[model samples]
Target: MTKLALSDEILMKIDKPARYIGNELNSVVKEKDTVDIRFVMCFPDVYEIGMSHLGIQILYDMLNKREDVWCERVYSPWPDLHAILKEENIPLFSLESQQPVKDADFLGITIQYEMCYTNILQILDLSQIPIEAADRTENDPILIGGGPCTYNPEPIAEFFDLFYMGEGEISYDALLDLYKKMKQEGASRKDFLHEAAKIPGIYVPSLYEVSYKEDGTIAGFEPVYEDVPRTVTKQIVTDMTQAVYPEKPIVPFIKATQDRVVLEIQRGCIRGCRFCQAGMVYRPTREKDVERLKNLRTRC
Candidate 1:
């Protein structure tokens, strides 16, 4: 049995103790010694809200499919447990192994909305990581931000080590393989980040220098190194039918905001409403095959 980070006493005091426990059905758990990478996926909100997200579920299943990677999950503690952790000096832990998120190799946060911005800092602080990316040491988990908010990540760029632009399914495998190779070679964090910037869709904020005009408008933004690309293109999956989707999503103990199984039928939109950012960012709408979706529905 895995030892939970929180005590029985602490669990009893919290409203939904099951939120912190790790034995949810279909949740992935692997031996620490078996995997080269330990990635913690975070939603930066309460468990109920975080558990409802389809993107996180897909990534969790996708990453765990790799034998070299042991992907776990974490979510922002609710007010009651948040205060308890602060008072007791308990570190924020992942759901699968109930291990400190700080110990993971990567802490990938899904930045779905602007409202959850502050919660990102809370997650870092509770995990015992430096809130500022520059202040962090090599020992700290690599802070990665993804999701829709990353389209305009300038405001929160300083908080994250790197941002994964567009769909994760495209570039994540390459990124993880690079990290694994670099880790085996004993590459420094700085060296790894510099090389990681070269990967398509990866934006390492520290490598670029931004200058402001006298009127506070953007004057210039360019990479410090000549080798780095001037533009980081967004990655997209051309064929959604072959893309990985979670066949068996973990069922939360409590009722989540979206409790039913979710199936992503399509990406982008043909209508292309001007007001909608998703429709604009996710261009050239691609949809899954009807036959595949039917097969997936039966499996679910």
Candidate 2:
């Protein structure tokens, strides 16, 4: 499969011209031939902060390894970029394919915490996609979320069609494969989600009806559809050393929070702060495989 030649014109149109150019030494690139799924991996935060996330980079690399899958990036618009989007009426797009978020088969978001709530809305608004799962149609990308915030995936449940709890290494493929198959059969978005809810780690808010007691405590969450779990179990990957990354990283011209090239050192911290969801959800913190860093060291 031939690589899509990222044009200079597209980069020029963007506010941070460097973000679009992918020339980093560690970034991953897969052949375009015989691919099955295309994913637009989005972060609700600005490019600067999101670039500091090593998990996103790892997942992006691993997911792109398959010949059938292509994964790119979309981020919340900066204030200036948001203004440009508002004035130009331009939609949110991916850094790799430069395709609008609407066109992607799966729209995956990394939710590290609660602060990105409004930013999620802003991202969808900028992407020109619906904010609520109920509002979107079958044509829209199946909205998915992951990261620490998924443990209490109640408040934002209305927005995301599916939540990928814990690490998404395998679940990502399962979700996309389900979508690719269901889509081939002309299944509606609702039907796909109802079935997708059956997959472990995928919490589809729309399928499970939530009722609260008079006191506002969650009375019970029940699935309208059959086979949906009463409690959606979080996905966990035992190994981290085998993680994948882009062979040529996307080097942003605009300086990010981590000015130097970045990499993930760990997953799921054990701070044990009762207030923190990730602290509890991602139990049993794990460190990166020391051997993997041999490559990361070369780039740093």
Candidate 3:
């Protein structure tokens, strides 16, 4: 029998019970026993907002493409559900498998904005996972933070075991494969994180140490180990044409912020506003080929 953390009574009380239940059209369903790695991609907000983000959808499609991996979706429950879960002592669960996040191999949270910091803590608390990375045991999920906010991840660095510095498409496969091999060898959490830092675009917070100046500014950021790289580089796809894009995005049961197919005509705005963070990080503005766009438009 399948186990669900949210009961019928609780679902009935929530405004949109669809947010908790999985199996909407286009969602990936796989036998949990068959996969070596289970990754839960989380967004620190309500379902509608998280569903609108394109980054999670792309990663979901990319990870599920691997036969050995099953990627699931999770969003911060609404206040009503949150209260009930806390009151009833129910652990927060993934929308797909309805399993607690601690069971997953990795718990990846996308930090798009600073305001979502509190919500991230809420996710950890509600899921029965440690809120701080330092407190986590070997059995705990590897807490990872990614997305635009990763550009300046210092503020919430203590909460995440590691941060993916740039685009997920480039380095996630290598990271996941390394994790599977390491887990097979019965590697300790510390050992796994140390090895993971070797991968480009992956920044292991524990591997480095930070010192502050008297004025409350960052005085020094140094790696604890001599072997670890002093700086992590951002991963980028050289050719957008060759990049894998999500063809079938998961459709939600209730209305989402964006209820239609969204085409990424281009990445990195050409305007290059001096103060724009996205423009700077995703610079050199690349656009999809007209032929490819036309084909995609016709197919959808």
Candidate 4:
């Protein structure tokens, strides 16, 4: 059995203790020593809200499928526990093993909304990681931001080491493979990030230089190194049927905002609505096959 991060006394005091103690149904648990990479997926919100996000579920399921990777999860602690952690000086921990999130190789935060910007900092602070990406050393976890908000990540760009520009299904494997190879080679964090920038859909903020005009509107934006590509393209899965789908998602102990199983039947839209960010960013609509979805439904 995994040990709880919060003490019995602390758990007793908290409103929803189930949120912190995570041995939920279908949640992935693996031997830490066996994996080369320890990736922690975080949603910068309370457990219930974070648990409802389908993107985190998909990535959690997908990453854990790799024998070399042990992917765990963390969410922003509610105000009650948050205060206690601050007072006690306890590091934020992942749900699976109740291990400190800072110990992980990667800390991937899903940035869905502009409202959760401060919450991102909150996650970092609680994890005992440097709030600024530039302050972090090689010992620190590589901070990554993804989701819709990454399309315009300038506001929170300084906080994140890298941003995944599009659908995770497309480029994550390549990035992970590169990390493993680099780790074995005893490469520096900056060196690894330099190489990572070359990968499709990866945007390393530190690698580029952005200059503002006198009016503070626009100016020059280019890579510092000549080797780096001028443009970081957005990745998309050509075939939705071939993409990964979580057959068995984690069932939270407490009631989540989205309690029932969720199956993503389609991605992107054909309407091309000007107001809809999802329609604009997720171009060229793709859908999963009905039979495949039915099979997934049965598994769920």
Query: Clashing pairs in model 3?
Result: none
TM-score of each: 0.98, 0.85, 0.97, 0.98
Residue 270 local lDDT, model 3: 79
Better of 1 and 3 by lDDT: 1
Q: How many residue pairs clash in each candidate?
A: 0, 12, 0, 0
Per-residue lDDT, model 4, residue 250, is: 92
Cα lDDT for residue 88, model 3? Answer: 90
Greater-TM-score candidate between 1 and 2: 1
The parts of candidate 1 lying over 4 Å away from their true place are none
TM-score, candidate 3, is 0.97
Best to worst by lDDT, what's the order?
A: 1, 4, 3, 2
Q: Compare candidates 1 and 2 on lDDT and give the better one.
A: 1
lDDT of 4 by residue, 46-159 (tens): 999999999999999899999999999999999999999999999999999999999999999999888999999999999999999999999999999999999887778899
- Give the Å shift of residue 132 in candidate 2: 1.6
- Clashing pairs in model 4? none
